[model samples]
Target: MMSRRQIALAAFISPLLLSTSASFGADIYPSRPIKIIVPIAAGGANDATARALALDLQKKLGVPVIIDNRPGGNFVIGTGAAASAPPDGYTLGWALSAALSLNPLLYDSLPYKPNDVEYIAAISKSYQVIAVPGNAKANTLKEWIAEVKKSDGPAAIGVSSFGGTVHLMAEDLGDRAGFRVEPVVFRGEAPASVDLAAGQLPAMSGILANLLEYHRVGRVKILAISSESRLPLIPDVPTFIELGYPISAVYWNGVFAPKGTPKSIVARLSEAIREIVETPEFRARLAAIPDVNYINGSSDVMKALVKADQDYYGRIITKRKISLKN
Candidate 1:
C-alpha cells in the first residue's frame, strides 16, 4: 500500500528484524534449566550415562541439566514425552539405539517416529557381555555352549528387558551358536543380576558397565564380550569375535530433541555436547568403564547410524520372527 521506496525500506528492515530475533533465540537458548529425559529406570546403564552427561553439560551450559526417568513400555513412554515437549531445545531425550532402532520391528505401533526427533550426538557405545555366577561349572564360552546343548530344557538367559539390545544379542547368539536358550526378561539389570547370582539363571547378557562392579567382586564370570577386540577395562576377557563368534553390536546413547527444533539450536547443543565429550576428564571417566567408548559425530552421522541399525534390526526381527510377547 506504500510507494516503491517505502516498500524497499520495509524489506530491508525485515531481514534485520529476523537477524535480531535469531540472535536473541541463540543467546537465550537455555535461559531456563534443561530437562533430559532418560527412558530407563534409575540405577540402570542408561540412567547412569544420562546422569554423567548431565553433570558435564550442566557445567558447560551454566544451567541445571535435570534428568527425568520415565521407564517403561520399551522406551515409548519417555520417548513420547520428549516428542510431545515444546521444541525449544530445553527438553531433550537420551535415546538408546535399541529403542530408536529395534523397537519399530518388535512392536506394531510406537508413540513417536524416529524422524520425530532431531539427532544431536552420540555420547557412548557399550559392548554386551555374557556372564555367569562365580560358582558356575562352565568357566568358558565353549563349556557353556556344551552345557546348553546337553541341557534338556532351554538354557535360561536373563536379560534386562524385552526387545532391547541385550535381548537381540541373546537371540542372535542362540541362532549363531547353534544352541537353544530361552530368554528370561526382567524389569531391570539389578533384579536380573540378583537372580543370576542366586543360580536361578545359568547365564545373562548385558552391558559390561552394569556388571563391572559385580565382576570385580568375583561374584560373576564374564564368558565373552560382543566387541571387535578386548576391552581395556577387562583385558583378560576375550571378544565374541575372537572366540570365533562374529557377533559385534555396540549399544549407543545419544541426545535428541523433538522434531521442528531450530537447526541453530540443534547445532549449538551438538557442539556443546561434542566439546564435553572430548574433554580429558570426560574421556578419563568413560574410559575406566569396561567396553564403553566415546563417540562424537555430526547430526547426519548420528541419523545414519540410527537408520542403519533400524533397518538391520528390522530384517533380523522379520527373518527370525522374534517376538517379545507370547
Candidate 2:
C-alpha cells in the first residue's frame, strides 16, 4: 500500500529516467563539440564547403564544430571512419558523390557499405565543363572534335582524381562525342591546370572550380558546360545539350552521419543546414566556386539520391570496366 505522494513521485521519475538514459542518444544534442570529417585534403571545394558549413553550424548550434581531414585511400579511410562512428550525431562526414555512388562499384572492399550511413542533407552541387588552352585553334566543341579526330597520340584529359565522376564524365564525353581520352590523374586540379596552361595537357573536363582561374586568365578556354540551360555567370558558354551532346549529371556535396543516428537529432541538423543554405550570404560566398546549387532533402530523399547516382554512374563504370580493386 504505497502512499499517494510516493506513487505520483515514482510515476513522474520513471519517465524522466527513461528519457535521460545516458546509454541512448543525446538528450540535448550538440551538448558537446561536433567533429565533421572531410575526405579530401584541405583547400579544395569539399574542404572549403565543409569549413563553411562548420562555421554556419557553429553559429546555429552554439557549439564548437571542428573539421577533421582524413584524406587517404581514395576517400575510404575518412568516409569509412564516419560510417563506423557511434550512431550519435557528434561524428559526421562529407558524403561525396564519388564515395557514395562510385566507390562501391569501383573498389573490391570498403570498410562500410552505402547503407551504413544516413545522409543528413545535400549542401552543394557542381557541373562539369570541357575546356582547352586559350591559344588552341579549336574555338568550339565541334572544332575540338575535329581536332581529336586528327590527333596522333593518346588524347589526354587531366582529371582531379582518378576514377572519380570527372573521369567518368570524360569517358562518357568521349563515348558520346566519338573521341578517345586517356585520363591523366594529377594530385588535384591545381597541378592539372599547370599542365593544361603549359600545353602539356590538351583538354580537360571537370568541376568548373578547377578550371575557373585558368579560364579567366585565358590559360584555358571553356568550350561548353554540361547544364541544360546557359548559366547567368557565363551566358556565352553554351550547354552541351544544345550542341547535340547532352551529359546531364550534377555532382553534389552531402552531409552524412553513421547509420542509426537518432532521427530527432538528424532532423534538427538537417533543418539547420537547410535554413543556412537558403541565406543570401551563403549564396554569394559560394558563387566564387561555380555551378553550385543547394539541395534540401529528407533522409529518404538523400537515400534515393544516392541510389540514383549509384545506378547512373554504375552503368558507365561497368561498361568501361573501371575499378580500383582496393
Candidate 3:
C-alpha cells in the first residue's frame, strides 16, 4: 500500500547501499603502510631488488613500503616470519627462487610450505657468473679449470651459503668438469665478493648484476656467465654453453602475501606490481643490468613458475642427495 514515490526511493537506496558496502570492503585493504620482509641481508641482490620495487610500488599505491631484513637459515627465518603474519595485504615477502623453489629440497624441515603464500609478480630474472680476482693468471674458464686441476689441494669456491643455488652450481661444475670444489661459506655475497677480490678465496659464483660494479672497476674478472646466450652489455664474455659446459638456471625475484589474504587485495597488489614492472624506466634499468631480464606476469603465471622450478630442483636435489643436514 506504499506510495509509488516510496517504492522508487527504496529501489534507488538498495543499489546505493550495496555499492557503499562494496566500497567499504575494498577500503579495508591496505589500511596502513605495507611491510616487505627480505630474507637475505641488506645490500645483497634480493634486498636491492626489493628496495627498488618497493620504491616504485610506493609511488603507485600511495602507501609507504618498509623493508624488514631477517637474514638467516638460508631464507627460512624471514620467510617464516612472513608466512606467520596476518593474512592482510600489509605484510609481504620478497620471494626468491632459492627460497620458494629450492629450499624444500635442501632442508628436511621448513617452517612454512610453498603454498603458504599467495604469489604476486616477478620483478626480475638474473643470470649468474663465475668470477676470479682481477690479477688471477687464468684468463678463461678453460684455463681456470686447468689451473684448479693442477693445484695440489682442492680449489676453493666461495659461496654465500651452503645449499644455495650457487652451491649447487659450483657442485655441478665440479662434477661435470672432474675438478674438486672446496666450498668456502660466508654470511652473504658481499663478503664473499670482498674475500674473492682480496684473493682470500680463489673464485666465487654470483649474480652478474651484483658483480658488475667490481667487473667495471677491474676488481674482479668474470670468467664465464651461465646463460643461454651472451649478455649484450658484455658480449665479449662467453657463456658456459660456448665454452662446452652448458649449465643455465634463472634466478628470479618475486613478491608474495601470506596465504588467505583477500582476493581483492591480492589483485590490487598484483596489479600494482605489474604496473611497476611494466614501467619504461624500470624495464630500462633492469635491461641495463648485466645478464638481468625483467619478467612481468600475472599471479597465476608466477605461481606456475614457482611450481615448475620447485619440481625441477627437487629432482636434482633428490638424485644428488644434496641435503642441508650436513
Question: Would you list the C-alpha lDDT of every candidate in the order shown?
Answer: 0.83, 0.83, 0.82
lDDT of 2: 0.83
Over the stretch 126-217, how does candidate 2's per-residue lDDT look in tens digits?
A: 88888888889998988988888787855688898778988888887788877777998888788887788888888887887777777888
Tell me, by TM-score, which candidate is best. Answer: 2
lDDT of 3 by residue, 23-132 (tens): 89678666679999999888755676788888888887888999999988889999989988998889998888888888877777888888888988877888888899
User: Can you list the residue pairs that collide in candidate 2?
Assistant: none
Model 2 spans > 4 angstroms off:
1-19, 23-25
Model 1 lDDT tens row, 149-221: 8878777889987777887787778778887657788888788888777777779998888787788788888
Stretches off by above 4 angstroms in model 3 are 1-23, 284-292
TM-score ranking of the models: 2, 1, 3
Tell me the spans in candidate 1 whose CA falls farther than 4 Å from its real position: 1-23, 287-291, 324-326
* lDDT at position 39, candidate 1: 87
Q: How much is 78 displaced in model 2, in angstroms?
A: 1.0
